[model samples]
Target: MQFSIYSKPSRKKAWLLSALAIALLGSCGKAPVQNQKPATEVKKAAEKPAPAQAEAQTGKVVVYQLFTRLFGNSNNTNQPWGTIEQNGVGKFNDINEAALKGIKELGASYVWYTGILHHAVIRDYSAYGISHDDPDVVKGRAGSPYAVKDYYSVNPDLAVDPAKRLEEFQALINRTHAQGLKVIIDIVPNHVARHYQSLHKPEGIEDFGANDDTSVEYKRDNNFYYVVGQPFQVPKPQNGYQPLGGEAHPLSDGKFEETPAKWTGNGSRLAQPDFNDWYETVKVNYGVKPDGSYDFDSLPADYATKSVQQHAAFWQGKDVPNSWLKFRDITFYWLDKGVDGFRFDMAEMVPVEFWSFLNSSIKTKNPNAFLLAEVYNPALYRDYIRLGKMDYLYDKVEMYDSLKLVMQGTGSTDAIASVQQGMADIEHHMLHFLENHDEQRIAAPEFAGDANKAKPAMVVSALISSSPTMLYFGQEVGESGTLDSGFGDPSRTTIFDYAGVPAHQNWLNDGKFDGGKLTEEQKQLREFYVKLMTLSATEAVFNGAYQELHTVNKTTQGYTDKTYAFTRFNDTTKVIVASNFASTATSFALTLPADLLQQWQLSGGDVELKDMLSERKASLKVTGDTASVQIDLAPLESVVLKF
Candidate 1:
């Protein structure tokens, strides 16, 4: 994800130079052994059992998306565009038992370790037998993780020993599972780094473009879409763009030779793509013809309702394309290594047929594997989930965008009901998040502009449906993504540069992984997040039926458009969640309609209600057919009432 909207290039360049210089001081060789103990002993330390095991797998999957390189960094230097040595990179070794435990305490069922895959970066790793990528083809000091270079290996920068990078990642996966948390890594199915090459792939597994007849523009078995007879030409720098800030490099002549040029990652077929295009990567082919026709058979209509086993059976006799088989093999390699799931990037760009074959094959091995895809087209949601066999799709364009409107005080809670109603059939297949690597931070001036203002929205995101909830690392501590890191703007954390997060560093507390350094207000905000996530993970009602109360109360006396309320309950537990999005404190008598009263089997009487978050008690008076509860809410406060 790119974030270049709020940048100050002049100042950022200085910091970038400092970081690069510091990184340059290092010898290009295998790093010193982190610990004198044997490999087995060091592995044991990483797998140390936490004092408290994470809660058992619940209906709700709480995901914590940690940008692995930055999660453990403690340096406060934060010089925008600094080098690895200046900013300090967080190794897989740095995510220790204490760190995992802290994430578990926040109630994450899965830890999405972003940027784990081997990706193209400008870092010089020639000493480790890895070729350094040209800055002309790379996107930042540290390149975008989405532009993956190798599917079989982990990023070498994340490992103490570059040769043992895979082993280090495996240890991390083991630690995550030990904490009762599953692991999710990114799989960029639509494209790969411009210089895609896997030096560490398993034996007999051919590289993506290997054995391809590059003379053809399109082929059923070719892994890439090529522009026949044309050579790839680097786009001239638009918008004052420069290769590595105009730094002189032996290979920085704005030229990359690729005869029969491949199509750009975003499907721009031009030999010279625009600078704003996804020029750092190239699109992967999946048997779709130039006329948008499929070169493969489509899934039968009945497959939507069939079991994953049946789905797998359907593909048994078919001869799938080369790209499909390649990705399937990649998934199996990781699944064999104990990866629990994948967060597929730009999954929709690839044909749904490929997903059917890929996902079915995955489920046949691990039925409980979490398959969340980045699909924003609501019209295609059901098809991807049912026919394509995906487990979840992002609710970004609708729920997330709507919630942002509510949080910004420009929208109504009325839309929340409509959103839920529209997705009633596929509610469980949607995933919700208030902050992620791609979105603007809630505390950033471009977004809510205040972390506290996220409380109400967080409640709606987590408690509104049975869908999984995701939290970006440092979100709880209100890490405003306002740093002007090079190649990226403020308002979103820098995924492209090695920079320390100020607020998150406070919670990291110099690797202690405790909140000892957080201010009182920051601590309180984190506590609120803990309560919210904890309830979502352990509460049975979150997995049960949901009914929006805002629609019924819109015409009520004191209720405003900025307030949203909902009810979730199972056979034995009931929860009423309400949020106030206004600026000042507001009081309202939340009314439960007759249908809800009857659903709860409550006649006309007084029932005690307890606030699950603050542990305060209040009484709900049931009169006639509806129940009314008077509540005083602080601005941006949300309450979860349990009966």
Candidate 2:
């Protein structure tokens, strides 16, 4: 979701918005037929699914974060800078039962469907009563999914019937549940698309910035910040750029008209934002004072110890902020449609107190609702987890970064212990993942340059702690992410443009949802992933106690900086995990500490330990107060030994 973190924007390009298409770009150089639903039928719920009952059956979550716009795309015409006409987009209908079954076979319990919200795109939906978005503000022929245009409607590009998009999405949700998979969608509360118009808002709800008092720069009740006596002007294209690759349109004149310009999404007050800024959207206000003070009441000191009902009652009669109510209503609307959870985008940008109100209300309604937040600050991790009532936060800076360093052969295996020990108190709240939409692909040249290198990292990320694990759509199939996607480079998939993923398309196998076209190496890599995921989901020891053997074996004979070891066990099962991050094969005697031996009640003799990843058994030679196993590991290999 970030545009080159290391690259800073110059003053000239800071105000320029990357111009895209003014009309919708359908795949295959042909306009898709738009089906219309009858006006009499409306999307309504039949009955609520009991989440508590479902949670009892579903132990831990293994999320497959599928980019909805690109997941089912089968097009292979990967012409660089190609329009959507050349590279077709995936629709909701493409997520058929076979697709869900394929994902389920990968041992996924939940599907995080990204980009389901109705965002501002350069599509000409004028025939369906929807206006076209200006290419001057849109990111690509498609649009940035984070720049939400409507809070109540589903993206029309994802449905067969444009008018019945919400119903089609509901059917998708139902189908996902039929395969025993829960659905999670993104909720961007920090900002909305610049042309924020909710065409399908409920009867009583009003659109954002509609009733704002535009005379002043800041108001407690206002939804947006305005530049007094100023008019909005589009920034001039930079770096030899032109809208839609020089495609001309009447509205692409770089002359957007806005009297009393509003603040940009990144809090820039400039009348025209540079291309590097989040200019396509506008920031939302939550009653914060101009001097960085709170304008509304703060939470009481003892709010953490209160019940959900008590927290809900605390704000019953109080005059809360308007923005808070709008967000709460939006969440309620999604929950009514059977969305099992939400992944809040840039959640740390907003105040944590609002999350207290919003998340508490959500948990009150469904106690098992998954609330995952994108928070990167280490200092605020505890506050967001305990006070904000979030279920999980991304462990990116610590575990993911450290593992990436190990994958690149630049870091010591000893660092994994510190990352685990530091988060010991709140480890369950830290969600682990090697690849997401924002990070680089594992097989990309900028990363490890190989997907097999992710095995050890995936082992620790999934089984080291009792937290949830996530995998992006193509991570399992070794997607190199080296495509010259229009707006996005090769290291990451294009979220802003329309394109097909190469490796993922191979697995799509012409909509068969089977790995019919995969090579031998790719098929083996996928099988390794399937085994890892299945073990993580079905193992009893995954939820048990954790102990680090890496610290003890760092100085042991045959153990080097490229190796790591750990153990997890409860009363019934004891599992030992060992990994080698080196490029060459090595043999080592994995010696267990005396404390671990006593914990597992092992005496000096021979014990059988089974390797879960390779399904090979080995005998552990036990001495007086310790146990040791002779292991031969392949390059970048990891093993899970169970007794």
Candidate 3:
């Protein structure tokens, strides 16, 4: 909380100005009508087949994510703690209650909590990144929820009773189910803690492959950041003995290293020092670890052939406690807790086998559970696992690559074409987004840095890609996702911001949505997020199959910018999701297949129509071949047509 970090910008004045401005842009696009039956209204609708018929006819599916724990324990509040100014503002504190309530209201089919269990940590590395000492964050909270200390227990601070956390978690699940939302907790099965009671080994403990019994202290080796460590390794540890270290069961088919020396340690977290003392554990050969620890730790493995064993997440790989599950349990508990699914954290570092296994497991609980990948380039999926599993992954490289080629004023259409070609060539298992947790927010992604144009660009990719779509909070309304890269700032994701309303400020006051720190911009952006999330939860266009209509060129790059327009339609419903990312208004058109036009013009079952966010009816004129309409969108805006 220093005056030095960011020259604290004046928020109050801007707050007053934007509140007034929403009215000018008060385009309350009519939300899709609710065929959704609350528990009370279900009886009458149960006999009526509206919802069921539509579902059966189209085979629709939707994903609703909570983005935090308390969706693990979030609460639903009635008011803001104080006035919008000088008071309890846009923060979510009580996650449990709010999550239960938000699910049904938002209509999320699946609810996901990012981190909810007893998140792990290194003596100090977990909280301090590579530093050996703890960093001064809010109350010295050392690690992100990604770091796991204990797998079985939930975070004590999150619940009223530190001891009965799991019980309370179950209660949260029941409450969520009452609201018709499914829970999905986080699961980290690859690595364990540095000095947990289960895996501590003293300095003199006999080496058993990777110091299986040593207190996890691999700071000297990079491969052990989250791998396991030697107990005496930490300057301060609760136990006199070192913690046991863990590693992936070498699942690769390559030549074995025969010793831990070749495997320095895990460097992905970049949170710890390197280790050269791993004496226990064999890295699989099916895939090579990023650092070449053993092999196949990254590739898809044949679980049936290999004997399975590994710890949970390791904050630091070297000299770290040998108990990381890698990418299994922590996220799994979210699913266990009734969260719908997760936007996988650093998916690339995790082996492809884990995802395949978990995705299948989730089906038993809730087949509709949605899993979106944060992989660098979904196009990389061209290297499909002979038996890999996952619903969708983000295509990071291609998004930036295409943005540079197209919007930056230098690339040819072929440049953009190849990117789409990769999309076309790959299987239909992907989720595309302009931004998510790790990168900078859309309003200020290094490429465009144009707050006004970010939303349109992000939406362009989200709507057109064959993968299921998503809107990271704060993408719309031009809010940035900039993080304090110098220090450990709890993740806000490179995801787009969709919240930009007054309700979030009010919700923050009610004391459930606060995440400790937020600015006025955060509050405004949360409103847009709520609307965007609501749209995703409620619309049919986004949930079903989609195809790009036209506009290979002519869309601008500023406000009123029009990019590719697409349509998500079924026999009974036809929704046009048209977008323009440039500042000047542009017109785009689409022609429906004959089957669609015949059904529409004849049956006129195009009974209902609405825009996703604005909640307004769409304007249109239908002739013989197609229904013609000129959509007017502000730069960085989209129109979701629902029928």
Candidate 4:
């Protein structure tokens, strides 16, 4: 369905005036300008407040994913394959009270400290008795965070004192909590580094695969699935690729010793995995045999709907996989250290039942533990949520993909309505994000190439439902991810190398933790995100019922496919949201269906609608079976109009 809007230059003046007034009032910390109407006009359409059912639901979750290693690295020397000394890494201490307070002010309830765990790196810490990783197995100068080397310790590169790395991380967690934000760290359940060894495991806890029978290909209790007989062979460098750009290093001989090979992290069973495979890591075994049959007890059918406590009870006295127990202990250990939650890496690669056992165990320890997972398959969404007991799954396949297409001007906003409808039953379980460590930055030439293009999309993503909204570090001010930082391709912020995020550094502004060096456009973009995210976290209407106005307004004049509209409301508060993906200013009549008007118990009259973000005002005219509000939106503009 196509939608078009007519030009309305006059409304721009009113909108500017409203925005200026709101900004002036906001500086004084006063309430926004109220609708000036006669008492008779105000009382004409007043109705009873809706029930507090939506309020009874869980509060909205807003996550700010901060790449721990990059968040505070003030050094702008983004030299390719730069060493820690040359590039300079951010320490846990850099995320001080001021930094955390800045994050808190950005409306983040949880700060996902990505890459905090001890991962395989090229840097030698032999003085601290840490074994050096072979450059052939490591992905970059700074290894991939998913190739975790130790579950019990934090990354040494992020510490002011490498000997006290864990202590520094704990201090960071405390600071995060002090700022009213919870902590979330990566839990790579599917794999560990190729040379996995836990030097800091707790007493009486043997390392993974320590007691495994390596002679067999698969064992029910084995920590890793082995390809017996064949010695592990390092993948041959291809496409002219070399470890550390063919740099001279003692361990860069294209050789890694293993008497018997283990499966690759991505489930490649070959002893000589392709260079494209996850060759740096080995997959963890969770009792699923080579033939894909379960080697352990399976949950009953009714267990899908069971509570976390019930799921935990079901696993009691049951013989589960050894890897399951190992992960459980590791996670529990972190919980004891005050981590509030985990972001499981490639969670779908592991079996669902294992998650059921692991996640339930986590909830038993902390009922409010935020369990978010990276499960890309939409087909497995329900199974993971219901059976696996996942608190949140990435809404990438549908919500993120659709919005991205809209931003690129290659897809219609109608697809967004369809996605919301398809996932209506499990909307809250899906987490929304526009940018992350994995995805291309919105400002990258490969993406929309402009940070401003994401403003409307971010508005919809943050306010669409009760699900969590996530903002990657530097997304607020548009880090283009255009740097060729080595190992990984450009367009995605390099998670594999020691490099500084230039745009993020500008906001860092020499550790001031303020956007001191940001341009006016960048500051405005960040302000838009700040307002949207704060409302998402603090507003009840976000967690309320939703109704799509896109389909209903398809045939309406001045309404086009480039514009999307919807409403989220609860017992008391109601908001109409609209976004223009077009590149030009457009004016459209945003219509609220008759059913919604009836549900809201509003009689035919003129209702004032105020833009929550910009403080712009519009009048909703209700006459008989029709209701619509004239809306003027600039290119990539979005509004949250509360009546």
* C-alpha lDDT values of all predictions: 0.82, 0.80, 0.39, 0.82
RMSD of 3: 15.8
How would you encode candidate 3's per-residue C-alpha lDDT over 1-643 as one tens digit per residue?
A: 1111211113212322332111111111112222211112111111111110112212222344434422221132212111112111122234455534544443344445545555432222223222221111111122345444444455444445444555665565565555555554554332333322212122222222343322332332222333333112211222221221111222212122221222211222222222211111112111223333332133223432331122112111212111222123334434444455555553544445444444554554456665665445342364322233456655556655565334443443344335665566452465555544444444554445654454545445544544544443334334343432222121233111111222222343444544333456554555555565555545545545555454333333321223556676655567777655555665544444555457556332233457876887755656565555556666556777776
TM-scores of the models, in the order given: 0.92, 0.92, 0.57, 0.91
Query: Candidate 1: worst 10 consecutive residues by lDDT?
Result: 34-43
lDDT of residue 347 for candidate 4: 78
lDDT of 1 at 255: 93
Candidate 2: global Cα-lDDT? 0.80
Q: Scored by Cα lDDT, where does model 3 land? A: 0.39
Clashing pairs in 1: 3-489, 4-489, 16-81, 19-82, 19-83
Model 2 C-alpha lDDT per residue in residues 1-643, reported as the tens digit of each score: 5452123222212322321111011111112233222122223453443331153323346889999989999998866556668888889989999999889877788899999999988777888788778878877667888899998887888888888887788888888888888999999988898888898776667788888999998886688878889998776666776666667776777777678888777667789887666777887877665455665566665876677677766655566667787888788788878898999987776777778888987988778788999876677788788767889999887888889899999998888999999999999999999999888899999999999999888988899998899999989999988887666557888787778998888888888889888878788888988889888887868888999998887777878888888998889998899888889887888889998888778888999999999889988999999788988889988899999
Global Cα lDDT for candidate 4: 0.82
**Candidate 1 lDDT:** 0.82
